[model samples]
Target chain A: MAVRDWEAVIGLEVHAHLKTRTKMFCRCELEYGAPENTRTCPVCLAHPGALPVPNERAIEQTIKLGLALDCGIAARAIFARKNYFYPDLPKGYQISQYEAPLAGRGRFRLPRPDGDREIGIVRAHLEEDAAKTVHAGGATGRSVGADYSLVDFNRGGTPLVEIVTEPDLRSAEEAVWFLRLLRQTIVELGISDAEMEKGTLRADVNVSVRRRGEEGYRPRWEIKNMNSFTFVGRAIEAAIRQQVAAHEAGEPVEQSTYDYDADTDRLTVHRSKEEADDYRYFPEPDLVPVEPPAELVERLRAELPERPADRIRRIEPAVGFDAAVELVTTGRDRLYDRLVAAGAEARVAANAVMNEVAAAGIDPEAVDAGELAKVLGARERLPRDVYLEAVARSADPGFAAAPFLEQEAVSDASALEPVVEAVLAANPEQVQTYLGGKEGVLGYLVGQVMRETRGKADPRVVNRLLREKLRA
Target chain B: MAIDREQLLHVAHLARLELRDEEVERLGAQLNDILAAVSKVSELDLSEVPPTSHPLDVVNVFGADVPHESLPLEEALANAPEREGSAFRVPPAGS
Candidate 1:
C-alpha cells in the first residue's frame, strides 16, 4: 500500500523541568549553568542517612498545570522508584509516579487550520530529572562513541513534569501543533521556562503506522530525548515512512528505540536498548502519598489564565485564525484588545502589532495602547515612514503621537497640482503611454510627483492631480 | 509460589548484579523463604484494608521552595573515586 494509505498513530511524552527555586527533594538551588556538582547536597547526592523531602512549590506548580489541562487530579498520588543503574542516577533509581499519577484523563483542544483537534491527555506526572553527563574521548564536546563520561549532579533531583498524550494525533504536523499549544499554556501559567535550546523541554515520541481505519494498534517505535520541535516532527515522519515500507514488505516493525541524526535526516536503532523494559517499580518508602486538599485545588483552578484555545476562539472572528493564534501565543492579544477599545480597527491593529511593532523590536508590554491608536488612526493621512516611526517610538517612556501626527502627507489637490504637472511634463514618453490607454503608467507619474515633493505629497492627491492634467 | 533459578537470575540481572553459581543457589533458597514468609499474609482476607506506602500516617510533607547553602565544590567531590575538574568522572554509559 502507498504511504498515504497508512495512518500514523503518534503520541508524545513531554518532560518539562519546572522553574522552581530549589530541587524537587533537596534544598539545592536549581540554577542552570551552575558549576558542576556545586549544587549537590546529602539528599541529592544519595549519601547514606539522607532523607528526601518534597518541595511544596513544585507540587503546587504541577497541580496548576494539571488543572490548566482540565485533568482530574488524583485524590491520592504516590511517588515510586524506577530502578536502574547509570552514572547519572545517584540513587540508582528515579523517583516517579507509577500507579497513581497526579493527574489524568484530560483533553487538550489542539487548534488546527481546519478546526480544533481534541487530543486526549493520558497523564501528567511529576518526576525528578537525572544528572547531566558529559562524555569524554569523543570530539571535544560530542558524546557519541566516548570512552568515559563526567557526571554533573547539579541537574539531578530537579522537578520535572512528564505530560503524556494518547496516540490521538494522526500526523507529524498535528503533534507539533499540540506541543506549541502545550508550551504556551505552560509559559502562561508561569511554571516552567520550557525552552528547548536550554534542555528544559524534552520529548519522547512514539510512532506506529497501521492501515487506514484498521481496528487495533501496531507495535510502535520510540524516538527518545528529542529537544527541538522541528527535529521531533522530522523524526516522526521518517519513522512513519520506514514503518509503512516495512508493512508493505510483509515485515514486522519490531518495537525498539531510535536516535535521530537530524543533520543526516536518518533514524538509527539503539543497538544496546534491550526489548525488555524491566524498570521494576514500587512505591518510594521515603515519601508519603499526596492528597491535595479540596480548597487548594479549587484555588489553583480559579487562578488559571484564560486557556489558549479560548483566547484564540475569542479573537478569531475579527482577525482570523492565523492572526488570532499569533496574537494569543505571543501575548499581543492584550495590546490588540486595548487598541480595539481605543477605537482602532481590529484587523489593522493586529497587523500593525504583529508586524510593524514586532519588526521594530518593540515589547508589546512596554507599548502604550492609546498613543499607538492615535498613530494608527492617522496612518492613511501620514507619510508611511512617519507612521512606522511613530509606532516604533510608542514604547518609549512618556511617548506622545502629536509630533508624529503633525507630519501628515500633503493631501490638498490644489497644493499638489504644480508638482504633478511638472512630473508629467518631465516624462512625455510615459505620459504618451498613459494617453495611449496604459493606466498602469499613472502610478509611475504619481511616484515622480511624490519624489519632487520629498514624499510629503500624498500619493492619492498626486494620483488625482495627475489624472486631471493628463485628461486635459 | 517460589521463584525458580531462571527467575532469580533474571531478578539479579535487573539489579545489575552478577551472581556466582553457589551464591545463586544460596540466594535463591533464601529469596524463596523470604517470599514465602511475606506471602503468608495473603492467606488472610484483608481486602478491606487499604495499601499503605509509608509507615507514617502523614501526607503532604513538603519543604518550601527555598534554597539553602549547597556543599562547597571541593567538599562535593571529596568522596569521588575519580574527578575531572569539578565533575565526577565515571565510565562511558552505554545506551
Candidate 2:
C-alpha cells in the first residue's frame, strides 16, 4: 500500500521527574550524579517493616502541573503497587496510580503546522522512579552483550508524574510538538527541569497505522524509553513504516514492545504481547490517598502563570512572531514582560533580547531587565557593537549604561561636516570614483566618516555631506 | 471465584518465585479458600458507600519537601548481596 493510503495513530506517555528537594517517600536528597547508592534509605531500599512518608512538595507540584494543563484534580487518588521484578527496582514493585490517578481528562493543545490541535490527556499520575542500572563489558552499555550489571539506588524513589495522552497525534511531527509544549508547561510551572539528556523527561511512544478512513485502531506497537525528542520522532516513523510494510505484505503486525537503537536506527523487538509482564496492581497500603486541599488547588489555579500559547498570542503583535515564540518557549517571556513594565518599548526590548542577549548565551534572568531596556532604548544612537557589549555587561550587578548613553549620534550638519571632510580628504580616490558616476563610493565614504567619529555620526548626515562635497 | 493451578503459577511468576507443581496445587486451594471468605464482603449492597483503600481516617499524609542527611555510603551499601565500588552488583540483565 502507498504511504498516503494509511493513517498513523500515535500516543505518548511522558514521565517528568519532579524537582523536589527530597525523595518521594524518604528524606534522602533528590540529586543528580551523586555517589552511587548514597541517597538510599531503608524505605527506598524496601527494608522489611519500613514505611513510606509521602513528600508534600511533590503533591503540590503535581497539582500545580495539573492545574496548568487544565486537568480535573481528583479529590481522592490512590497509590497502587505495580508488581514487577527488575534489578533496578529495590521494592520488587513500583508505587504508582492505576485505577485512579491524581488528575485526568485534560486537553493539551499543540501548535501544529496546520493549526492548533488538541491532544486529550488521559491521565497524569504520580509515581516513584526506579534506580539506575549500568551494564558493564558492552560496547553499547546495554544488557544485550553485557557481562554484568550494577544498580544504583540514588535515583530510586524520585518523584515522577507520568502523563498519558490519547491516540490523537497523526504523525511523528505532531507527537514532538505535543512533547515540546508539554515540556514548556512543566518547566514554566517550576516542577521539573524536563531535560531530555538527564533522563528527567522521557517518553514511550505507541504507534500503529490503519487504512485511511478506518474507524477503529489496529493493534499498536510500543517503543519504550526514548530519551530525546528526535529519537521519539524517528522511532515513530520507523514503527509506522514497519507496520505499513507488514500490512502491505499481507502479514499481521504483531503487538509488541520494541527498543529503538539510536546508532543502528533500527527497532528491536523486546517483548511481544504474550511475554508482557502481568503487574498485578493493588492499592499500596502503606500510603493514604492524596486529597489536596481545595483551597490550595484554587490558589495554584489562580496563580498559574499565563501559558506559553496565550502569552505568545498576547505578545505576537507587539514583538512579532519569532521573538514572541523564542521568549515564551525559552521561559524568558517573564523577563520581556518585566522590561516592558519597566517602561521599555515592547518591540525594541523584544529585538534586543532575542538578538543581543540570547545570541550572547546569557540567561535573560541574569541580566537586569531595566538596564537592558535602557540599552535598547538607545539602540538608534548606539552602534551594533556597542549595543551588544552593553547588553553583555548589563548582567553584572549594579551595572548602569550612563557613560555609554552619553555618546549620541551626530545628526547636526555642523557637527558632521568636519568629520565628513576629514574622511573625504583621506580617500580622494573614492571622491574621484563618486565624481565618475560610482555612487556606491558614497557609501564607502560615509562608512569612513562614521568610523572616524567612532560610530557616533549618523549615516544620513554623512551621506548627504559626502554627496554635496563630491558633486562640487 | 476459582483459583486454579495456572493462576497460582502466574501469580508466582509475577512475584519472581519458582513454584513446584505440588506447591502450586496446594497454594491454589489455599487461595481459593481465602477468596471464598473475602467474597462475602462483595455481597453487601451498600451502594452509597465509597470504597476505602486504606483503614486510616486520614486523607493526606505527607512530609515537608526538605532534605535531610542521607545514609552514609558505607551504610547504604552494607546490605547489598554483592557490591562493586559503591553500587550493588547483579547478574547481567536480559532483554
Highest TM-score model number: 1
Tally clashing residue pairs in candidate 1.
Answer: 0
Model 1 TM-score is 0.90
Candidate 1, residues A127-211: lDDT per residue as tens digits?
9999998888865554556788999999999999999999999999888888888998998899999999899999999999999
Which tens-of-lDDT digit does each residue in B1-95 have in candidate 2?
Answer: 98777778777876778988788877888899999999999899969998889999888889998888887889878888898988899887764
Model 2 per-residue lDDT at A288? 89
DockQ of predicted candidate 2: 0.72
What candidate 1 gets wrong by more than 4 Å, as runs, is A138-145, A273-275, A410-472
Error of 2 at A331 (Å): 3.2
Summarize candidate 2's per-residue lDDT along A189-290 as a digit string, tens digits. Answer: 889999999999999999999999999989899998899989998998888888898999999888878888788877888743344567889999999888
For model 2, what is the error of residue A49's alpha carbon versus the real structure, in angstroms, after optimal superposition? 0.7
Question: What is each predicted model's overall lDDT from 0 to 1?
Answer: 0.90, 0.85
When only chain A is evaluated, what TM-score does every model earn? 0.88, 0.85
